[model samples]
Target: MAKPIARKTSRGADRMETTLNNKVLTEIWGADQGVGLRVKQAALVVLGIAILAVAAKIKVPMWPVPITMGTFAVLSIGAAYGARLGLVTILGYMIVGAIGFDVFAGSSAEKFGLTYMMGGTGGYLVGYVLATFALGLLARRGWDRSFVWMALAMLIGNVLIYVPGLIWLGQLYGWDQPILQWGLTPFLIGDALKLVLAAVILPAVWSFVGKART
Candidate 1:
């Protein structure tokens, strides 16, 4: 009888731990609330897209590549919204940009739609979606629950953005262009700053959430 009771209690404790570990901030903020949740989620996605658009427009000019707040916004959205919603939000942003909306970084009246997407920055744009998805997966796994893990997750997402961006840039300009000088070296400091900022903000927000819940 004692052995059976002990085993049952252990199982119950394990389940409780799993439940606690799986609770992401998005769900904690009521994303799991049934019918109305869909509407709220849709709203969040739209908001995220808007944020990305705005971030894209804020650029620090550089040769070949410019620094933008877009990466920070992408990581934040992924951490705040979780995997499914983050993926949807990024995809929606890309769709809007592809359709000729002036939402992409440095987008102009002369450049819009699919034509603009296939431009030099196109690979980076696609990378945004992948990075968001990666970050969101980590967020779902509770990596966003603390500072260090969140920072590491965001850093990984940042690197994912660079990989495709560099490849596309290299393809476009060839070896003559010095791809590292154009694509990677210029943005390292900015990306590092963004990573630290995200790492601090997410854990701070989680702290607030914990207080609110209590």
Candidate 2:
């Protein structure tokens, strides 16, 4: 009886020691953690942004604007990073492009012009930031796994990006109807495909990554 009690005491003490150690370590690293995490996050966002531009280069020209894989990166990054970080990353990319960097689609280093980069799909670019917020909202609510929910997530993302994009495109063409003609009509099918693909892949990627983390 004494032996069992002693053993139980030993186990309890060990568990307590472990918990204390964990708490201490967490406290020690907590401040650095926020900074480190932000740095790491920014790096990932930059990579995602670069990938967006690279994807555009792989475009298969179709209509008003060429269909590019950039949209995939846009939608995927949001679902992957959640709302806040996703928005930050895409917004960071836009800021970089806006500040006269050739980081946007078709803005070759040789040409290196900001006009095309900021003018053509600028609305969509801004919209991408909004999409990230929308996508992140649904994903955090545990809708990341459902196809219907994920599809809705992507659809909302597209709408967020496209609507403002259409308005801007309309402005550019100096015609109110340019949105219907240039923005929405031209990219409907392609955007739908991109949304479907994002919806399919985001949950799987997150799930796989989650399993690894666990």
Candidate 3:
């Protein structure tokens, strides 16, 4: 009787491990099961927020909106964390910024807290959340495995960010404000570079992971 129970327990453990391995790559790579998983996930959220803060600070000044690596970080985190955790992580970052942390692109005494969130770049920030969600969904679908598919996924995420951003800019400055020049054109080249880099990096990482697993 004791031996049968032990064999059953072992089988259950094996099943749990199999389930974890079959999940999205990020979850498989970063998470674990049982009692410690929640704590591990919380730590991942904090780390994601920290990464966003650092990326926000690496910017090139431009009119209306400064070009920043924040977008790149957002998409990358999504692709690496899956939908639920990715959304949680991004929302955590936003909440931190909203509560007056100096985590935004150009934090200053004059521009912090909710006031900054409601500024010209506010839409872009919201877009980051949406884009991250989208990318996370794609990542769960295993879109990150191929370079072409990953590129398309990243491109979609990039476009998602601009949509809300442009709309908000239009509303703030009105139709005659040349919103495109200020909000979109300046960042085209930079965004393209980021997109390509992300596309390349994700597929390469997936390849490396495959190699390591084998």
| Model 1 misplacement above 4 A | 1-20, 60-66
lDDT accuracy of residue 98 in candidate 3? 92
Collision pairs in model 3: none
Candidate 3 segments whose C-alpha is farther than 4 A from its true place: 1-22, 60-66
lDDT of 1 by residue, 19-68 (tens): 65676567676556788899889888889999999998898765445678
Per-residue CA lDDT of model 3 for 80-116, tens digit only, reads 8888999999999999999999998867788998999
Q: After superposition, how far is residue 169 of candidate 2 from its true place, in Å?
A: 2.1
TM-score for predicted model 2 compared with the true structure: 0.72
TM-score, each model? 0.86, 0.72, 0.85
Model 3 / residue 126 / CA error / Å: 1.2
Model 2, residue 166: what's the lDDT? 78
The residue pairs in collision within model 2 are: none
Off by over 4 Å in 2: 1-36, 61-66, 109-114, 176-178, 209-214
Cα lDDT of candidate 3 equals 0.85
